[model samples]
Target: MVDGTKKQSLTDNTIGALLMLNASKHGSEIALREKERGIWKETTWAEYAEEVVACAAGLEKIGVKPGKAVLILGDNRARLYGGMLAISMLGAFAMPAYPGATLDELKHFLGEVEIVAAIAEDQEQVDKILELKEAGAKGIDHIIYDEARGLGFYEIDGLMSWDHLIEVGTHDLNEAPGRRDEILHRSKPEDPAIFLHSSGTTGKPKGIVLSQKNVFAAAKNGHDAGAYGEAEEILAYLPMAWVGDYAITVAAALLYRFTVNVPERQETVVRDMREIAPTFYLAAPRSWDQMLTTIQVGMEDSTRLKKWLYHFFMDRAIASETRKLNGKSGGALEPLGRLLGELLVFGPIKDQFGMSRLKNAFTGGEAIGEDTFVFYRALGIKLRQFYGQTEISAISAMQSPNEVRLHTVGKPAPGVEVKIDDSGEILLRSDSVFAGYYNKPEASAEALEDGWLRTGDAGYLEENGQLVVLGRVSEVMYTAGGERYVPNYIENRLKFSPYIKDAAVVGAGLDELTAMVCVDFEAVGHWAEVNGVPYVSYSDLSQRDEVAALLHEAFQRVNKAVTEPLRLQRFVSLPKEFDPDDGEITRTRKLRRKVVQERYADVIAALYDGSKEVHVSAQVTYETGEVGKVERSLPIREV
Candidate 1:
């Protein structure tokens, strides 16, 4: 285990104070940019700080005080970011909720803290807050909304517009010149700056409180380790509720003085990203997989000559990358061939994905598929994996440029110490580690022992100091034959095939393994069209005889790589995709194993009872907040 004592001095600066410092030192530098109506708008550091001061003063006028919590519901926007810093300026915790959270989920978060005010991004967010208030949620006395287009007609008692709030704040600030500096200095390093929650993959989400010190320490460590550099360009598109987004876009951006760019809308993220061509980027594995699928599908429709060139070049490039990853040198002509391929094929692909300027890109939150990892590297993108949790300010270990590996999550991050316990759980100690879970002494005690945070994940340190994560310790399972395995490992391999989007491996004490798969509707649908197959809907297309044959071939290929006892014996393609609103997956796309097993108990029993088909009538939630039932008879296939 590495010692945590070899560390730099911890700074006493809060996030609000950092903003003030940046404004004074780099007043003319662009701190933020956002697209609106096909135009890019910029905010300088000075303006950003000024806006935060106004927002804090306005919030104080609406009963905001130190120790009170403020709800921030929205997509990534300059005003939303300013409002978050403004809350910190007042020494209040900024509680950001996922924009797509269901009303019930929002209610749970609201019940956890004493929220005095809220900042809503648009009319949709405002409506959810109004519904909660109508249902008798207390402590929320003011609602400040950014967009006023669809909300001008609302005649609510505590509702206000973003512009009006700023106007009031400016007036209040001008009344007392000394108040600006006083508000900027209100927060200290020990004060809680933000409130986050666990992903809830195992159960209900737990509230986590992080102080300014924790956020800054984590950001500083990443900067010191060369994760990001000063004035780097970054695209802020991930859900703000996730720790990854907050750590990089807000904390790190402020600390390193990077430019944070926000997309115009969710649908225009790709176009905006291409326009920005950010220097650094990070995304979950699912997103990387989707991009890969897009490229593959696009190539399928290209000219015959283009398709041939793609295969010829991609094959050689992947081979060369494989050798390098294994610490081997390539042929003398390999560099020339790579240059030619880049000009003809790979270069265009990178430009299309807006990764041409991505000097550093990362994938985390779960294990990435091997093919996906190698494909990007072969295309000349520096895609690496990192392992982290929300409790450790979102990161603890990450792959350096020189030590990239397929199975390990690189070495411990700067100033962070890692060790394994007797039970094989990974333990981490860092200045960035959170104090405890909010209002849950028992859970906090179980998570934090001494100064080390119990990650609850099973992993080990390599001889060279790299960390290899197997899976969640609690998720390890044994078969009736006494063979041990982690379902996620096999599941990730299954999803390596573009045809399969999600999979669940089940066989805790059974004779053999089985899987329930969700086919990628777009990828499979395109394949069906090209192969002259007919389908009416996702449900009908998934169970087609020809599609079953295709999946069987893919499954056979995966089975060839595993031990005979661990090979999947039976599989079923579900009629629908896993939806977060349905409680099948978390917002970050992690599977809810307990929920899935409980809901599919009947199907699991049928798989072991020699049944050829299982009838399913499941309730699904729609994006419109409506619940409906889907009934289908899924045919079980043998590998």
Candidate 2:
């Protein structure tokens, strides 16, 4: 096992100390870039350090103390990042809540912990927090806002602007120069740096507390594994509340002195990513699937000549790649074919997705489809899979370039020890393991044993020492015929088709397996138009016989890979997508099995009772926060 405790100059220091060191060594280097009004704005390391110091000073003046929790709510913004660091500098815990969480969810999170102060992005977040406070939420003494638009007229207690906070801090620092040193020295390596929440797929989310040493250890492991290099550029577009974002963008960036680029808005991420062309990137499996669908749809709309060229070259390249992955040699003409394909098709596709400069790309949070994995590798992108959890600082294992495999998540990362229990649960031990669950000693005890953190995932090691992660142990289901299977494995395979978006497989204690599928409206709509099949709305198009036939062919392909008993016997194309606001999925896009099963009880019954169709009246939350219901008669198709 790799020793994580091997002394490095910055490994023992807190995040605040590392920021100071970067400022001292590379003061003039660009540390961050943000898009504003369609122009890129840069911030130097010295300026970044200065702002953090000012923000910390201001927070101190506003009664923020050691061991307190400060809430950060927003998208990826430079000022929000600065606020996180400032909170760390003052020896307080930086608690980042999901920006899209409803007010009731926000209230629940607040009730779980005591929040002393909050730094919000704009009027929307400010309004939510104020509403909660007005509803009797306690311990929130201060609320600071970044954007001033639409918030100027309201006069409320303990609400101030970010600029005003910085001004107050700047004056305080000028008055007492030694106060800066005092503030910096207050935090130790073992002090809690961040407070994060679990995904809550099973129940109420647990609060996880991670120390500075934990964050440093995790970042060191990734650095030693060659995940990134010094001076590399990365796009910070993931949710700020996610542990992966904090591990890479905050911890790893400070450790390696990398440059982070922030997009202007959530909708413009693809456009901004292409403009940035970052060297290192990470995205969830769903995001990758969507990008692949975009490429496929674009090709479908291309001219005849271009479409033929794309298919000919792409098919040949994918075949060659498959042979290489299977440990077989490609023919002599493979090199020439690859060169031509790169020049004719792959090069332009990479440019469109801003992957030309990406040297290291990773996908985590869920299992990615094999087709999706092979497609990117054939297109000349170094996309790999990683296995991790919030308790382990976001990553425990990641596939290296030379060790790429379709099933494994790669060998254990540096400093992580992995072993399987007798019952087949994966257990991990490392310095990066979190301290404990905040305010829940019982849950903490259940999660940790001795020094090893019980991951609650079932998996085994390959002969080559690579880790093969199955779905959660609790999610492993058995059919009435005594066949055991994991639903996610089947769901991922069905989702490989560009026309299919999300899926849920259910067969526990039943005679045969079945599925609830959500179709990709844009992809299927394009296919319909090209084939002379007319449609009007998503619901109308989903119930069409043509759509059912298309999905049947896709299911038959997936069924060929599994045993007869495990194959999907039936499936239904739902009229709408699973939404987070409706509580069907988490913010990270993980399915809440209990919630989904309960909400679709009638549909599941129909799938097994020999019914040709099921009527669904699903509740949907719109972008404007309006609640409504969609009624449709969805057809169930046999494989």
Candidate 3:
């Protein structure tokens, strides 16, 4: 129990220390599990404690010390978790970089952190690190290779073999049992335990330094709010690089003694999730989008009779949810609709989506269109939206049972005080608030003022006490007519169109809105075949006169949803999806508007002024750096 009277430090009940506590309390509990060689590889709490001690010793022998940082690059695995625990046990914080980061982003990020040591999962990651080091990185001394698979590229001085280092730690721990005690004693609650880099979608990344106190306590609070328990088995399927995943892996699982399940691989997540049937689930909006995609795509391939039946019941279920949305109970038709939907359609859908017995599921990271929320809710899945950021340990507000609402991010989470500033920015003061951004006092001070973290996100709390996050404060643009509108607001509305994969709304200074849309080629291809619309290549399909008219209709629907100035005035369907690799989207699939606008400035300019058809020759770089020109006539549409 933490006392409110005492100021806590990072090492206090830290990743290592918390594991030790759980191990001492329930030594035999399954702490971690992952698939290895077609079999379940699990580590019990007691065993994890022993390994953390060994791993910490190994890191110490290789020069990891308090206040130092160790970069971890890999997928979710038992050894990866152990490596992080080891880093934390050594009183050093762990920084998990997304393995998917671009070479330039990785170089700048790792260099910015000045990471002293790193644990790479495989040779590919090690090669990337070596490349960055060659390109000018400082203070990196150790590179612990987990896979040890083809390590020809690593320097001899920097290399640390995984098993050999583990043996060294084990040998030393056996020689001196008190060494574990000494290492544990060195940890304080305020010590920097982990560095979660900001998304950097908008600007340069800032490392969010989380103390052990902030994480563990926030997890404990979540337990009360969501009712997580020791018996609960959770799938750690999200990226470990994000604080959301780490909160579950380290904070909730370690501190509260919950079982953390790691999927065999990204591809097998659906199968693995069904096998695990996690009691509590957390996902970004895209995960649910993918889940919906899986069902929709699978249904698309099903027999017409089965697809018809599925839609028959699904439509009824949606109507029931719609009634509930209108403050009406699942009355007369609601129960009948639910009963029939569950019996025929939703049961199988939920079973496949692995939502059965899913006590609570969270979807955040962006505004989920209201329809998606209703679909999950009608299926007996309590899908919710939580509001927070990296600086607040990723949870400041969350929707609670039965109190949940559509199109809102819910009320302030327990023990947190939320206020809407006069500027309409969400203000927060909470125990879970992060200490600050690492070594960036000016930015940190700007973020935190008068005991409140000024969440630059704009939103308002409603009469019902639920929150409605509009969009980023910086993202909202005002028209020459003085009408303010958020592009994300328009984009969210656009994504609800099943054929539209993603959209980036443009037009800040001109008369009205415009957008660059990426059609769901796969979905549209199916639509075209079914509707007798002739199409071939993605570029060919996107440029079709019929396709342009369909997109125009979609744009008009969204345009009508907003005011005249806020309505989309013109648009151009992008021949390709917004991709992170190409810098049009962030790693998490959020549109990088600035990047997109800059890259497609000519096209955007042509959309409003010139004719609906324009020829473009784009210089594109391939993955291997081969450059080529892709020439095409991009089709534009006007409202």
Best by TM-score: 1
Write down the RMSD of all candidates, one decimal each. 2.9, 2.4, 3.0
- Structural RMSD, model 3: 3.0
Compute each candidate's TM-score over C-alphas. Answer: 0.96, 0.96, 0.93
Worst 10 residues of 1 by lDDT: 1-10
CA lDDT of each prediction against the hidden true structure: 0.88, 0.88, 0.78
lDDT of 1 by residue, 374-437 (tens): 9999999989888889999987889998689998998888979999999999999998999999
Candidate 3 local distance difference test against the native: 0.78
Q: Give candidate 3's error at residue 518 in angstroms.
A: 2.0
Clash counts per candidate, in order, are 0, 0, 8
lDDT digits (tens) for residues 350-446 of candidate 2: 9998998999999988777778888999999989888888998887999998778888999899989999999899999999999778888898898
Give me candidate 2's TM-score against the actual structure.
0.96
Give the C-alpha lDDT of model 2: 0.88
**What's the TM for model 1?**
0.96
Q: Rank candidates, TM-score, best first.
A: 1, 2, 3
Q: Rank order by lDDT, top first?
A: 1, 2, 3
The sequence of per-residue lDDT tens digits that candidate 3 reaches over residues 255-316 is 66778888877878888888778888988765676577668778889999989998888877
